[model samples]
Target: MSDDGVRWLDEDQQHHWRALVMGTTLLFDRLDNDLSREHGISLAEYEILVRLSEREGRRMRMAQLADSMAHSRSRVTHTVGRLEKSGLVERIKSPEDGRGVVCAMTEQGWELLVAMAPTHVRGVRDNLVDLADPADFAAVGRVFDAVADHLVAAHPEMEIRGH
Candidate 1:
């Protein structure tokens, strides 16, 4: 209680931190590999499809989409460009604002999402959900929810949208 101000993690804390890092890294790696093999799409592309599908009119403003996906605007632009070439998504000038742009899911994209959802869900359950203790799983949700809240609060200018 009288040190010069660094609160370092002890052995137990270090173990938990490493466990979380390794678990998430491995889980995402497996998920990405599965998606690429089974659907010819990366996990990042699948996430973009899912988000657009969930939006009204299946569209979101470009900047809003980037913020929602935790990607930089330039990165989102590049991904959207790739998706566009794949015929899964399209970009258009926003109807309400001439200078703004929006990304929309195409019919092909929606069809792909419908076909891929089950496989992804099962993979998720097998790899993480079913393996976690029920109570610990609930705690995990709370931890991430709090972290998301803190991040969103800190960056109020990020312009995330419910869509």
Candidate 2:
């Protein structure tokens, strides 16, 4: 503890922390920009589509989608609204429940996702994956898994795991 009675990062810890922050920021920006430039869709929108595609029927309740993405319902709704306008996805009353709405990807959305997946994957490879050794990349995954586990345990009500 320092004079202020607060534990602080040492010089090496500070360096690594800053690198993590900057690297993630730049990496996400680059990935988002790549998707936006080539596919006319933001990374967030693409991610929503991906989540739906992986579901049993390519559909998910709006609330579940929001929870899976760790985004607010309103934010997800707003993005879905834009996607709906673009004819990429549709919102309908859930079949199991008349009250909850479900977001389903349209055929057009699936086609778009199939086409643009390569671009996103290439960006990830070029920007990050290929830059690291295999072992180091695996270590990164382990680090994040630990971080995610800690955070999820700290906030069990968030229900942000296992989509």
Q: Ten residues in a row with the worst lDDT in model 1?
A: 154-163
Q: Please, what is the whole-model Cα lDDT of each candidate in the order they appear?
A: 0.87, 0.90
lDDT of 2 by residue, 32-149 (tens): 9999999999999999999899887789999888877778999999999999999999999989969999999999999999998999999999999999999999999878868866
Q: Cα RMSD to native, each candidate?
A: 2.9, 2.7
The lowest-lDDT stretch of 10 consecutive residues in candidate 2 is: 154-163
Compared with the true structure, the alpha-carbon lDDT of candidate 2 equals 0.90
TM-score of each: 0.91, 0.92
Model 1, 1-163: lDDT tens digits are 3297878888899999999999999999988888889999888899999989878999999998888887899998998898999999999999997789999999999999898888789889999999999998989977876777787775423334321
C-alpha root-mean-square deviation, candidate 1: 2.9
